[model samples]
Target: MKLVNLYPQKNIEFFTPDTSTKLKLPVVTNGISAGFPSPADDFLDSSINLNKALIRNKDATFYGRVKGDSMIDAGLSDGDLLIIDKSLEPKNGKIAVCFIDGEFTVKRIKIEKDVIWLIAENIKYKPIKVTIDNDFTIWGIVTYIIKSV
Candidate 1:
């Protein structure tokens, strides 16, 4: 699996949401069929191991399928998988996956002296400034981008 740099030439700001609250993630297990009587046990084991390796260092990153063109100018298109890491601290300029007012969105974070803003790369979309009353939450920092060709 190759990781692509989505925003290579652009300088984007990053932000971290207050993660003092605990997050509960559900555990998922890959189920195996017991009725298969093939001699491909070795192959199956190897495949599983490979899958694990591809995602081992990436356990901290959550996968979310993108749904809009707001980030297209930044090279993030619709249906792309975003690798977001919540443990990474948000900085001045980086792409991040944020949850605001019960909705999840991928945007570039900008931190001003007195305000935080969520910026969209597309001209058709408007930038969102964080307000005191808004339910804003920065879910994670986007570390890698995976797109389908």
Candidate 2:
């Protein structure tokens, strides 16, 4: 997959998903407990390929490194990796990566009768209302978010 530097000034770095790399990693069959520790035997029963597991549509999938805190309340933080699928339908309440007036932003979509609203999860950030005069496009629907602890 070809990677492109799209809208660096907009705080989003875009890259095409490399579905060709199939790296199988051991997966724990039993769920990990948050409160207590458990036995480790029989946990690694199977393997998983992250490329296959994450990329639902290889041709339409893209990765974007987030660079802002607009969606911090939604668990998307700066430096978080976002898996976006262009083939997915952009419905109301879905988190999406959008291009508006030549800038890229990730926000929850709110579909009104005649207008689209980009709602930020942070209370400090105000929602952006998209109008017909502005150039807008729902680039892709955010499917998964990979974050570092």
Candidate 3:
């Protein structure tokens, strides 16, 4: 288990989707079965533009690459690409990309009346209780996750 430093100083590497160029990819309308192998279809059902499909707010959307396994149990693994929308309102139980104490971290939001908690999906890490003393902000909400098989 070796780690590659994609961004030397950041836990999440951020990038904005280039909407100027639309790349349409063939889409399979039918669902692929996991239990058994299905016959391959030669014809594509339709084509989809990833930029249009994934991004709802082009101005506020950003792609963040996961750097650690803090949220692995939440299905956000290391090296996974996350679609973040800054315009979305922050709410309880929503997974968010947060900037805390000069560093960025992705965690599940836990709003408790006056207090807020940044929870890690993996048990190895502990839940962070955010107080007024800390410089924290919910940068964006994680809308989608892109994983490589």
Q: Which candidate has the highest TM-score of all?
A: 2
Clash total of candidate 2: 0
Clashing pairs in 2: none
Best by lDDT: 2
Q: Which ten residues in a row have the lowest lDDT in candidate 2?
A: 1-10
TM-score of candidate 1 to 2 decimals = 0.62
Any runs in candidate 1 off by more than 4 Å, and if so which? Answer: 1-59
Q: For model 2, how does the per-residue alpha-carbon lDDT over 20-114 read when each residue is reduced to its tens digit? A: 77789999878777888988876688999998888889889889998889999999999999999999999999999999998889999999899
What 10-residue stretch in candidate 3 is worst by lDDT?
1-10
RMSD of each predicted structure: 13.3, 1.8, 4.3
The per-residue C-alpha lDDT of model 3 at residue 139 equals 96
Off by over 4 Å in 3: 1-9, 37-42
lDDT of each: 0.67, 0.90, 0.89
Tell me how far the alpha carbon of residue 102 in candidate 1 is from the true structure, in angstroms, after superposition. 1.2
Cα displacement (angstroms), candidate 1, residue 7, comes to: 26
Give candidate 2 misplaced runs (Cα > 4 Å): 1-10
